[model samples]
Target: MNTVTRPRILVVGAGFAGVECVRRLERKLSPDEADVTLVTPFAYQLYLPLLPQVASGVLTPQSIAVSLRRSKKYRTRIIPGGAIGVDLKSKVCVIRTITDQIVNEPYDYIVLAPGSITRTFDIPGLTEHAFGMKTLAEAAYVRDHVISQLDLADASQDPAERASRLQFVVVGGGYAGTETAACLQRLTHAAVKRYPRLDPGLIKWHLIDIAPKLMPELGEKLGSSAQEILRRRGIEISLGVSIAKAGPEEVTFTDGRVIPTRTLIWTAGVVASPLIATLGAETVKGRLVVAPEMNLPGDDGVFALGDSAAVPDLAKGDDSAMCPPTAQHALRQGKHVADNVIATLRGQARKPYVHKDLGLVVDLGGTDAVSKPLGIELRGLPAQAVARGYHWSALRTNVAKTRVMTNWLLNAVAGDDFVRTGFQARKAARLKDFEYTDAYLTPEQVRAHVEGTARQE
Candidate 1:
């Protein structure tokens, strides 16, 4: 054990909240006050909101991923590994490195900001046949896969295979799902023209969910308008339905509809990172339950925030409501956690978490969008302007902000290049080797699953 006088602070996940907490702690604390170390699977803070644009080739991948070491803020250490398990009683965290070595990370105080994992289902063949649109690699791979599918369809001798290649289905209609459908639709439209052998009319994009509207949270009026636009684009919208079964060549939905599709994107919803639940603490909807100050109750030096923590929304009149796991909420919660941590070290009063809803934005390719900012609704060009501006402002660095803007300008002028890379689609059968283990299995659960599958086989 390395001995140090500074009260060590170990923060997990380098998302918006973790980054903000580190920034605030560095500015407020001196070397004598506390030592801060942030651990993440990736060194960069991924701006998840713009991932759909990247997949559509509207923006480059680097535009959305921000490097943590580039900024010379407080002397904080960066651990390039995702934390897998913890021992709250021992104040020791076990993290698996990129090289698959499990090491112990001991700390005096720890903050949990590790984000969420895609919430998958047990639907037949869903895990093996579906593509998720959450990570940078996944997004990039899907873009290439979609483009390649178009190319293959245009050149294929078999009409059935060609049709299957052109039919794409996206599950979940929230922001991630909706934006993915819209952006990829744009990519397909732009790239399919290059394939003169194929008719554009043969292509189809479908969005399905077990809900009444595409984006139910966007309310009836605005959601209705968005639906009309999608309906006009010939993109099939199936509500109150989900994929019942998926195969390599076809998918059966709850409505008993069969669509031959080479591509199926799984963006249904997110669950709290499994790391939170392992803390031996209480949780709500898979997120670790924390006090109003973002501290784990009954633990003096433990804190959690971001997507993994079930932080109470005090602005809602003391109701035990967990804050929504959006990037907007994560960023603010991070700063507050840092401030509270700093105050605790100095014997000062910690503040409560309080934030009002700031509306929502949904970009639907080209210049079409749906947004409600400051209690005012806007659609089309106006919504596009606000949506773009909001994301531009959300990015942490000016270099990132400028690069994104430049990319957008160039995309508008040059149009998107729809060449397919097919990196992920090629590895669809072995995604577990590439993705974090948290997506599917807990260590114990994985052992049981392996044993069970082996026995059955």
Candidate 2:
């Protein structure tokens, strides 16, 4: 009797790249071709760009969190956990489940799409005192924290304490930071009307970046336009500056300015997932280095994309130039890599990933916006429409689309209630609280774990 062997394809992460790749694989591959498995800490694929809106109460958390199980054609075995290590030689992935159980998942092929985590520095009290807006819970927590600050400021008798509570500092000039400052400032601006004792003038928002410009990717004209719009909204723009140190009550800047603030939102940048370290592979600026086809050079059946891989930008025609970690690229790359994976399994040649820039959008809340679609620069209301339309149309499912559309309409007409969910009432959260970057195993440990020689602590 002859037996047939099926290939096991394991995907890491539930991000845009991972979800897209898995969906495509399921659609393209037959049941007998391969068995697909996905390892993720969450069941939903988080639409990360709209996170600032969630933080500002413009959209509920569920609107952007598209459920992975919603697909009726689903065949992938969903693993409710995170891949802590990957032993390339043994072709095994070590996963830590939600219940803290360890499992060794053997795979014929592996696709690494574990997304990046918020990058931090060695500044004093940075991780201990600062809050991040990467995860859904973090965004919700931030909204509650911001409103709590307003409440505390209004109720406080100590003038100094009130001043500190009212003053907010957001660090980073990127999309997340800009949108966060713009949206939350609007939140506080409109929220002060509800608090009778609070003076709106007392609420101050400072947007700072060590870089000279706000959103340098938007080019000079659009960047200047964004900066002007933000400044006009009473947000203090401080370029060429960064936080030297953070404290419970205040933050010291590199320029020697001490700002009395209780809230510090850091969105500086992101480093690739720590899971990449387990492979003991070559990396570029902390990202796993992969070919234009997105496959590991020396390792067959191993692929990586999204924030975790430094994939070469084939459209640029330069080997040294790598694709920037963006949602647009990740979504496209996911589909492209899926085709490559299918072709590889079918014994066909894989093509290189090539894509041109499709422009950018920056929503500044309400009528204020800026976008560059197909190289055409747009600002104000037209840009807002373009930005929102692009986001709405890009949603994965009809349910997600409906939920987002409903949220947008409700927010516009009824506006926000500005209610806190008490996520922060139990305790304050740090960068380490949400992201488990330190939980990944080393290359040696990965081998030991896969071989069942290492003891589980």
Candidate 3:
């Protein structure tokens, strides 16, 4: 039987934005006002700031994800599917369910919060050869792969094979790349201690990027401090460089140097989801263009937010930029859009989106952190406390908050789980590997030849 009735408010993508929107609607509008339905491919909201901990084995995957049904304190119906295409003229959205079935959903009002996917560059052999740290499954795969590499290296007597397995290279100096490198480095250190045959010094981690410094978005001072701390932890930093060619067992640099390695992690950047393209709407940088009220230009009943929308930064004036894809902005935008949707029902004018930056924070695992809060620079424990506090408070469910805290308390008493058995089965997950290309792109038209096809198989 169909779950939703008409006059329904359809919200897409249950990340920070969609979740907040539904929560706010429950608080503001009575059940008699309108029926609210949330459609997403997943049933939980991912706490992104804690993802680094998941890859490090410090926090499990379940700790960061809040179940949608359990966490929803309202009467909103949750639909498990991702919107792939939209017929704006008819106000209908074509969705691809998680089980690969296509379903058509109609809505009176639409809120687009569908998040982004990994962005790809034209770098040679990158699409099929590199692994990304985007979702929970990706994070788990990385942890398993990294640990398995150590296990393989420790047992192998061949010097060449051991060297290839021991060297780990992470591309991109952004938070994902930087955190992945730091967390894995720590994981390796703890794992190798049990391997009496393996030398910890044999392990090498390289963090490469096209940019000059790491964490450039966090401003110059804090970004510099983050780079320094990482270097001190024995991580080799490579700036203004990127991989030229990548393969199953070797990767060559643009400067003509070649390094033999079985693992190449790609966390360069992200792009808007391919779902945006099928909307037949104007987009900037692959994001749906929205007015200050977060409403679509041609359609008054339609709205968009989060990584998928190119919302103008009103605080910066007419010549300013759009809001970034950070969790902070998504959460705020979700709440505001909920209010705007309600305002529409009452025939009230929508309010324009406006806000100032709340600074940035990056957790480097352990007790180490770097951040700029309210324009004041902080590092070490001071930054660590601030970073943890902010994330803990931002959690949508108290159960999630309690579980994460309990895990931390137990983790302090017990050391890391350093058995690296999963690394032996490195699956080689690439950017193009998880994309729903059949629906988004013509099979042979947009020839993004997924490189390293043989290695993955």
Candidate 4:
């Protein structure tokens, strides 16, 4: 009797792209046709766009973390681990589990969507002292740290110490930096009511970036509108400026300004995952260079997308233009890549990824927002509605959508108490303590490991 072998498909990462790809595969492919497996350290898909809200206490971390197993129809095997290395020649991916155990997972076809990491510079004391807004823990820790500063300032009689604790500086002027500065400023503004002794003017928020404009992708008119909104809220906008050095108690800007502050929130930008370096393939700005179809050049059955891949923007008709690293692109690329995978399995021609820009939304907390949905600029409550509506619709599961909506309603009614969760009490909650980017294997190590595993098998 002859038996047929099924193709084994392995997907790395659990971000928007990876989750969307898995969902599409599960919906389209039968068990007999392909065996789908996903590698991730967590079983939930993080709704990252709302992370600023999470940091600001408007939403809980659990509300944004959608469970991967919520869809009963999905039959993909879940390996609770992160891919540390990939050996393309052997068709094996090395994953490090939550328990710190390294295991090798082999596949006939692979999809890489490992996502991006917080890009850092060699500025002094940045990695050690500064806080990040990239992960859930980081967001929670930022909230705790921010509230703690208020608490410390309220109890202290020293004016200098109080000022240092009250002053907050945020780097970068993009969506992340702008939203973070806006939301956290509101948190402090609201929380100050609880501290009657604390002067509201002492609670300062300085939003600085090297770029000349804030949220420049929102276009000139809307970008100026966002800057004005932040400025009106008393957020000090320092355009064309960046941090020269970061200290535990203060930060010095490139323009010769030393601001005394205990908090420095770094939301500068992101780089592709370190896993891309292990592939030993061509890359554009640290992102894997893939064809228009989101497949590796000259390599069959291997795909890359999302923040980790430099996917061509065929819609723009620009040879040098690549898709920007955004959730909107990531989500669409995920579904398209899965379809192409299915097409390849069926021996059909693969389709190239082509999509026009939908628009941009930046929720500035409360009823203040700015959005350009399909080129129509909106502001205030109308823009707020569009921003929240887009996010609510973008949420993957019903449970996530319901929980987020409930949080919004409750926050609007009762308001946040500015309670500190004491996440900073643990040293591991620090920005440098998380992510562990150094845990990945180098290209040479990956080659040796793959050869050794093959010999053992």
Kindly give the number of clashing pairs for every candidate. Answer: 0, 0, 2, 0
- lDDT, each prediction: 0.84, 0.93, 0.83, 0.93
Model 4, residue 252: displacement in angstroms? 1.0
- How good is model 4 by TM-score? 0.98
lDDT of 3 at 178: 90
lDDT of 4 by residue, 1-457 (tens): 9989899999998999999999999889988999999999889999999999999999999999999987778798999988999999888899999999989999999999999989999998888888888888889989999999999999999999999999999998999999999999999999999999999999999999998888889989999999899999999999999999988898999999999999999999999999999999999999999999999999868999999999999989999999999999999999999999999999999999999999999999999999999999999999999999999999998899999999999999999878888786845354577777988999899889889877998
Question: In model 3, where do residues sit more than 4 Å from their true spots?
Answer: 1-6, 71-73, 419-428, 435-438, 441-457
Alpha carbon lDDT of residue 48, candidate 2? 94
Candidate 4 wrongly placed segments (more than 4 Å): 1-3, 426-428
Q: Candidate 4: minimum summed lDDT over ten consecutive residues — where?
A: 426-435
Spell out the clash pairs found in candidate 3.
148-423, 148-424
Query: For each candidate, what TM-score against the reference?
Result: 0.94, 0.98, 0.92, 0.98
| Model 3, CA-based lDDT | 0.83
Q: Write the per-residue lDDT of candidate 1 for residues 28-55, one digit (tens) a residue.
A: 8887888899898788889998989988
Superposed Cα RMSD, model 1: 4.8
Ranking by lDDT: 4, 2, 1, 3
